[model samples]
Target: MRVGAHVSISSSKATSDSVTPPHENIANAVFRQKEVGGNCGQIFTHSPQVWKHQEITDEDAATFREETEAELDGPWVIHSSYLVNLCTPKDGLREKSIDSMQKEVDAAARLGVEYVNVHLGAHTGAGVEQGLENAASALDELDVPDGVTVLVESDAGSGTKLGGDFEHLATVIEKADLDIDVCLDTAHAFAAGYDLSTAEGVDDTVAAFDDEIGLEHLKCVHLNDSKHECGTNKDEHAHIGEGYIGEDGMNAFVNHPDLAEVPLVLETPNEAEKGFEWDIARVKELREN
Candidate 1:
């Protein structure tokens, strides 16, 4: 059961660490993930709110690679900024999105991370085909390093956002000239109307994904529980087992054989009572040894 959380890679030690530190700069994510009992995880290079970029010194990047190889069981994924909207029809925004993705892929190379995760953003009235074309072409602009692969993530399907339907993911992969993959966020899929609340639903959803877009492309799972009901198009994440995709759904998800080898990187909420540590522990408890 390879499971972890999205730990902060904030240069500020306090924001990055949940445990006491003998920490080294941005490499603190490895320490933070270990302390939270996660063997695989995700990180944001800088704050995702604005368009700013962050730097990683060669020394720190080397240390991060060394410690992660020695400590973690799964690959690291860098989540791109929220402001990146590849599906946008606007010219300026599309350029910004491409540049942002380029930075993310480059950073993933420097950090020795395997995947760079991003949303397709919204179409904003470009319609589905044009939006998908925009996203694929935007991704085509990047000179992604050899080892790192950009993973287009599933969306919550709110408004004009793409990637809710499995076909949307397949379409981008087909259209993009660059080699890419998928990261299925469980809560987002649920909000997008793919049932995952029961054993049958989980099985059906996996089958649908396999049919629409081969399972071989599923590189990661954002193992989260949804705060909203199925098909609500809401994207709030709940503590594992405490929301609409409750204990049964979570248990089924963690133990599902089709997803057994895929790393589970949680983006669950940090509540007063339960956070990453608690959720990671819950996942361990759910999986059969």
Candidate 2:
């Protein structure tokens, strides 16, 4: 399994930030992974700011692939910007959202990234049903280049978010074409009230995902621990094995029969004085056990 974190890729190399051009970022991430003892990872292709547009040239995309392959030593995945919310109410904003999503789609295709994961977005006071429809419409309107597919990530279900449960994600995928997929976030699933820590709970959750969202569509997994309790409906990420998910829950996820074959990325908090040493060790232990 590919296990790593959401690394930052900054535009400026002089700064200590993790943000770099896609190629440099991947190369750097590989180094960071080795430094922190990670075997696999994921990163955002561009700056996540939705308000600020990012431009990618053909030479940049090509060089990025070349450098990443030459420098990094792990399977890599790309995350779309956080600003994209397909469930928006305003028509103009919806158009911009679609445009932005397509840009990422295009970039992913050019870079040959296997998956482009996206959040289903909060409805912003709009009805959940409407938000789902809007999301479906936006996805249907997008033109994804060949060899790249979009994965809708499950959220914490706070407020008008559409992907808190299997049913909501199923509805969106059902309405859209078959190419779309889903990425289950363990923390969000737990905060959304799915008890994934227990054997029975993990089985039930996987069963529901299979029956409702189609297990075939599950392309990725976000291995995060929730800072909130079950049913909290909040989005707070904690270091692995240190929060509400606990060591047992993480073990359950790592050893999950269904998730065993899929790639798992850590979006865990790893920047404190302690660094990601503990988090990496926890995942390694689980994988070994």
* Model 2: pairs clashing at backbone N, Cα or C within 3 Å: 8-18, 9-19, 9-20, 10-19, 10-20
Whole-model alpha-carbon lDDT for candidate 2 = 0.78
List clashing residue pairs in candidate 1.
none
- Please provide, for model 1 over 87-114, each residue's C-alpha lDDT reduced to its tens digit, 9 standing for 90 to 100: 9999999998899889889988998999
Give the TM-score (vs. native) of candidate 2.
0.89
Worst-scoring 10-residue span by lDDT in model 1? 11-20
List model 2 lDDT by residue over 1-289, tens digit each: 5666666555344122553334443345555555566666677766788545566677766766675576554556677778888998988878878888888788787776767788889889888888998899899998888888889999889888879988889999888874788889999999999987676788888898899888898878888888999889988988887888788878887888888877778888866555565677778898899
Candidate lDDT (C-alpha), each: 0.91, 0.78
Q: Which stretches of candidate 2 lie above 4 Å from their native place?
A: 11-27, 70-75
Q: What TM-score would candidate 1 get against the native?
A: 0.96
Q: For model 1, what is the C-alpha lDDT against the true structure?
A: 0.91
